[model samples]
Target chain A: MSPVPVLPAIPGPPLAVNLRSAQLVYGGLTLFDGLDLDLTGGCFTCLLGSSGIGKSSLLRLLAGLTAIGVSGDLRGDDGLPLTGRVAWMAQQDLLLPWLNVLDNVTLGSRLRGERPDRPRALNLLARVGLADAALARPDTLSGGMRQRAALARTLMEDRPVVLMDEPFSGLDALTRLRLQALAAELLIGRTVLLVTHDPLEALRLGGHILVMSGRPAIVQTLPDLPGAPPRDPGDPAVQAAYRAILRLLEVVT
Target chain B: MSAIRRGLATLAGVLLTWQMIIVIGELPPYILPNPWAVAASLGRNAGSLLSHASVTTLEILTGMVLGTMLGSGTALALGYSRRARRWLLPMLIASQAIPVFAIAPLLVLWLGYGMASKIAMTLLIIYFPVTANFYDGLRHVPPGWLDLARVMLPESRRWAVLRHIALPAALPALASGLRIAAAVAPIGAVLGEWVGSSAGLGYLMLHANSRMQVDLMFAALVTLATLAVGLYFAVDAALKRLLPWHPANPETTETG
Candidate 1:
């Protein structure tokens, strides 16, 4: 008998979102066809690809925001819907400019019929080092602060799975690194699917990176990072993985 | 260079032209009353004019409130429900097409010379714009915001979502509706009274015109004009007070 491959013990509930022969076509252009994925729980998987290679669409499919093709088949474990239970943060901050920081973070609670827990929201903000800016409105906040507030809001939903679509792509390097660390720390026990074009970001943050190609995506599962996350992206191992992802993206484009 | 200075300069020019015309022409006293003659008429009829003006003011005030409430209430109800929109929107548009002047006498016939006819006329005239504006505002909420609401919250809690997100977003349109209604409200009252009533600025003008008291007719016309301007400014002020972020709000935008 063959021995099973040993994996690290993951703390959260097991998640196995699998897609089989999933095809997406819009207006004669094929975004994806027969794409398949088996997302195992408790690992940060980054889907790396060039711009407009259906990376965002892939995340949307997993998040169940898009409909699966009628002729194609897609399935997930437990039949649990991701909407409201899986927090999806889009590329834009999407904060209500009229609402202050605390209100914005607690917005999920307001949406889900829960009384806004200001203290908990405040704590989350403080964890992100934004406690002092709680009362300020989103328009008054800087770009970095607004993104942090958006991240805090994404956490407020308390979802087990988080799908982030380039949440820190537009930020300056220092702010991006700071937020990347915060995300890694907060997402320790959760299942995270991050989509990014930057190979370095994928290497620094992802436990396992999936490189996708073609109109119909085919996944090339890359090696896992040896150590804990929030890794120094400049490390040799991380650089090697980054180069591999760059090659994958290059080939796909 | 400045808008206020330009406005003042224009006002000064108009007044000078008016005064010159009065001085140069040997015009009939009844045709175009001079500014001084009108002022003298106002002073002479101050006591009686004040009493009549009060009655007209009451009608204007009552009609304006009733019209605004009815218009806004219907707008909100129709806006919040698809059924209301499907049925009521077309009806509202058709109602606007039915001329208020054509209906004023009929309203007087039904409601008589009482304040009811005047308010009914005002409500009918001011309703279309307010309802249309409000419905469009509520309908035009950004798609992204709606997706955020559905993704972040439960279905049962959508009321709070609508209240917090949709209401404020719809406010600018509502303000615009209110401004138009304010301008239209007084005209409705005047038209209602013009058809059948013995009171209000409309009736006073009718009485003066019949008596060949052209100066007095001009005075009532002036009073009506002032009421319309005053009501419009009052709405503008209220809008600024409630929504300081509105683009037309002079204080906030100017200071920053």
Candidate 2:
């Protein structure tokens, strides 16, 4: 085994996100209207819903990437704006095909015109199990490997809050589960808002669970589970919670 | 090796067909010269043909460089500024509506019947394809990429996103534009020469035809065809090298 660069200590404290009176409309369709959301600092929140329920849109809105027709006052724990302090990972790996894995990991810094921290990026790639592919282009890597590189890139941001939109949904089931475990392990003690379609994925990793549903989508919080996540997917309690969420969403009803 | 063989085979076939047509029609050398007579003229007038070919090549090459630079600058400007898009883009479209041939005579009058007129014609011919294709490419960079760039690098300088992302993303499209530009470059230069030029393959062909030198005219036509084909392939090869990351056709290029 090759020696790995040590992961640097995580930067900044985790930030709780508070959104009040959020309204988002897409082309005359109101996705979220006057919706309020609260996710505690240093905790993981999983948001689940069927397609067109606006789970992804809600995440984008929080990211401040909603270009138009959105109104929200979203803040961190310090009662300041949370616009620049959030790291986002989306369903597609979105690694620039022209850049190698290492360069892609440090893309944020380069784009910001800052000197990239090459060692830290290498360490993150190592932590994500992609150190060997540091110089490889995105198209040369498999989907799972590409997503791993993306995870490394996301971690490179070192922000207080992390938002993921189905970051594992595009992978094969086994790869998705493995990546979920990896993401769960790496993202500990950060304000994380994850949107996923899989109830089991939510059961395994969500510290708190919220279901976004309704005509103008609204969130419904579930009762607290017994322990910290990433909980064992095979655990009976996790299984029970999964079934309950399915029933709640009327997936099997 | 196979590419060379295939090219030689096509050339041989073309020559054979030409010779057969001349022999069967009993055409005189003055009207439709025999392939042998054309080759003889090519050898006899090699010096003149080479000089004229060089002149045309220079015009096309200079035009290619200036046109690409101007077109790329325009695309970036159009992309970078709303004012440029709103004001310049309509004018650009309207200019294209005027047939270039109609303006060729005016350009010859203004720039004179020298290399300037020919080079200007080539630049005019190549500019729009490069601009439109490159601008379209710049505009169509996956929205996800820009969104991500905005989120991650909010403090990026005025042109940081354009430089780092949009420009690189648009290169493949720019290459497509260049391919079209290269193919048409010689046509523009020759068109200018035909309208009015001191020296070029077009001028040589016209002069040869006036003097009843059909074989010399055919030789000049061959020289022009060779220059156009050669220019296209050279540009194609250079593009492939410059954009190694952007393989011409990924699915086909990757056999391993």
Note the Cα lDDT for every prediction shown: 0.77, 0.89
lDDT, candidate 2, A15-109, per-residue tens: 88999988888899998899999988989999989887777777888887865777888888799988778899999998888889999999999
DockQ: which candidate is best?
2
Tens digits of per-residue lDDT for model 1, A1-253: 4332222234358565666776777667777777777666656778888887777777777665644442344454767555555778877888886678899898877766678888778777877778789998787778898999999888877777778999999899999999899888887766788998888788888888888776666778998888888899879898777767767767533
Off by over 4 Å in 2: A1-6, B250-256
Docking band of candidate 2: medium
For candidate 1, the lDDT comes to 0.77
For candidate 1 chain B, the 10 contiguous residues with the lowest summed lDDT are B247-256
Could you tell me how far off, in angstroms, the CA of residue B200 lies in candidate 2 after the best superposition?
1.6
Across all candidates, the chain A TM-score values are: 0.88, 0.94
Give the Cα error of residue B30 in candidate 1, in Å.
1.3
Error of 1 at A188 (Å): 2.2
- Name the weakest run of 10 consecutive residues (lDDT summed) in model 2 chain B: B247-256
> Candidate 2: deviation at residue A110, Å?
1.0
**Model 2 over residues B135-194: C-alpha lDDT tens digits?**
999989998888789789765465788878888899999999999999999988999999
> Model 1 off-target regions past 4 Å?
A1-16, A19-21, A66-79, A170-174, A251-253, B1-10, B23-26, B46-69, B72-80, B154-158, B245-256
